[model samples]
Target: METEKQYVIRCGNGYVRFNLDGSMIGCKYKSSKTTESHMKRLPFNIDLAVASGIIKIEEAE
Candidate 1:
């Protein structure tokens, strides 16, 4: 089995992380300081969101 590395991007007061293949895996809420917050997957790509001025992606470490 292959495990692709995940990527995290800043969103609002929280964060959204997706797989290298662009699948949303998990997220966190700023209020509870937990990554277990459930979120809806966007119909478009995260990269596309950045390109289209929908969201800004933060630099990943």
Candidate 2:
């Protein structure tokens, strides 16, 4: 079985999580009022976006 790699990074005015290859998994805002806007900028869901399945987690280049 393969393993999933997850990492958190500061993106824009919030924080974001993505795979090693830079596939954005989720994001969060620094402020409560702008939380919704931050979430919308992400491509995936933090609660469900995993590195498993067909999503191959590779190294950054």
Candidate 3:
């Protein structure tokens, strides 16, 4: 049977990241509409995004 890769989601105030299998050799949301507006202003790092769980490792690139 096929299996899915393990991952972890680390969400912050503005963005979220996807950690593939966790411990990839590196240390390491959403409230409402108003929060969404603020989130847009903030710049979320893609590296962190993938680190959390939002984007897949391959998707990082």
Candidate 4:
């Protein structure tokens, strides 16, 4: 990515920008907002039945 592009940092997370020499340009602790909506997301489906002949992938999708 280009350095001119803006970036965002999240809470409990930080970013390390690298330079062309493969060195860290700088490190910054970004303050990103957390929404409860994200927490409400369910885990990915990994049921064997879905992959087997029981259910179709379209149904899971």
For lDDT, the strongest prediction is 1
What TM-scores do the predictions have?
A: 0.37, 0.27, 0.23, 0.25
* Colliding residue pairs in candidate 4: none
What lDDT tens digits, residue by residue, belong to model 2 across residues 6-57? 3334444455454434365445642212233343455665334333332222
Q: Give the candidate order by descending lDDT.
A: 1, 2, 3, 4
Query: What lDDT tens digits, residue by residue, belong to model 4 across residues 2-61?
Result: 323243312123433333343333335432222223222314332443355432221100
Candidate 1 lDDT over 4-59, as tens digits, reads 33334566556656544456544664222212122224445555777776545543
lDDT of 1 at 61: 40
Specify the highest-TM-score model's number.
1
Better of 1 and 4 by TM-score: 1
Which wins on TM-score, candidate 2 or candidate 4? 2
Stretches of candidate 2 exceeding 4 Å from the true structure: 1-7, 29-61
Give residue 6's error in model 2 in angstroms.
11
- The candidate with the higher lDDT, 1 or 3, is 1
Residues 1-61, candidate 3: write the lDDT tens digits.
9543333333432434323333222224221112222323445554565566664422121
After TM-score superposition, the amount by which residue 18's alpha carbon in candidate 2 deviates from its true location, in angstroms, is 1.3
